[model samples]
Target: MKSPSVVMLRRNLKHIARNPTSVFNAVLMPVIVMLMFVYMIGDAFNVGVNYVDYATPGLLLLAVCYGLGSVAVSVNSDMTKGVINRFKVMDVPRSAVLTGHVVASVLTNLIAVAAIIGVAFALGFNPSASFMQWLEVIGIVVLLGFATGWLTVALGLFAKTPETAGMAAIPLIMLPFFSSAIVPADKMGPGLREFAKYQPFTPIIETLRGLLAGAPAASDVLQALAWLVGIVVVGYLWAFASFTKRA
Candidate 1:
């Protein structure tokens, strides 16, 4: 018998392969946004750092946003089309269905990251991190994307319609921007700066920046992981509650 996770992974890959256009959006939109930020802000702002370098981490986080948004839409479409109802009747493992979608989201985001890296290079960004640092960056992206997928899945399950899913997603999607994504938290005004410093996103963005800048990992990594853990726990609970209600 196939391992449950492996079975789900294969099933997700097959489904994703059938609709390459959705896959293409997962790859292209983030790259375009990254390019826009790199060019528009690369020279326009004097942030006292190389612009592409400054923007890379933000772009990476933006990739997470793109992936999560797409996941919500896809999951909502599945639910709305009665496909989820069919799955429930077919006796598929509930965890497997969720994991399959999460795995697919990770794979799709990885593709978007690769494309963004290429664009970063063309825009003259240079990474100074060692091999291990590079691995750490990838690790952060993977975990972050997975956590965001869980959140998106929760939103998809709870929302009454696909349109509602999009509306519900706005705040979470806009979070990185108000955090350390584009500019340092300290650089913003007093009120906004205070808010940014305490939020979950700051630590994650800070960790990414430290890694990219070849600095020591901040103590904030622990905080970021704590936040990820808490969100994942609550997100899964919501997802399970919604799944049960609708099942």
Candidate 2:
């Protein structure tokens, strides 16, 4: 017999499989952005390297951010539709309910990441990372997706409706734009530059850029890990608290 969380994972996966819009938003949107950057506007930006190489890491992060809305909406749907309540009545382990969504989300986001990477390659995005560095890149992306999955789950739980839950994730989607994703933070004006530098996503994006360049900074790696840990901790606690109260 499968564990309840595994069963829930399968259930959520089926839901995602049936939702074409979710898949498109999660996967294709980032690819489209990459195409736009690499082909259209790439010439205007001078990042001291090929724009494809410089921008792919940030686009990868964008893929992760774009995928968060579906997770939030899915969780909000369950909450608003009483699926969570039904699970409670059936004696389902409460943790399994949220775990299913989080795991399914992480798995799906990874597929989105892979698709973006493929598209990046087709557009001439190149990285100098060795085999181990590639693995590290994968690990960081997974950690980011996992951490943000819980955050979206929490958002879903807090939202009164699925639409609102989707809206709540807009900040997340927009956050990458404010970071060093498309351009270096130094290019920004005074206040915005400092904000971009200290924000959570910048370190993560920088770490990814460094990893792809084969020289990840220790500070960036550590800061990214710290942010991931903090997000997971806060999101986990808030999700369970909301679940307990709402369900």
The ten-residue window of minimal lDDT in model 1 covers 66-75
Model 1 pairs whose backbones collide: none
lDDT of each: 0.79, 0.93
Q: If scored against the real structure, what TM-score would every candidate get?
A: 0.90, 0.98
lDDT of 2 by residue, 1-247 (tens): 8999999999999999999999888888898998998899989998999998999999999999898899999999999998988898988998999999999888888888999889888888789999999999999999998899999999999999999999999999999999999999999999999999999999999999999999999999999999999999999999999998898
Model 1: residues with Cα > 4 Å off, grouped in runs = 1-11, 14-21
Best by TM-score: 2
Cα deviation at 37, candidate 2, in Å, is 1.1
Model 2: how far residue 64 lies from native, Å: 0.7
**74-173, model 1: which lDDT tens digit per residue?**
6777778897778778777778877778888888888888888889889888878888998998998888877887888889888888888867777777
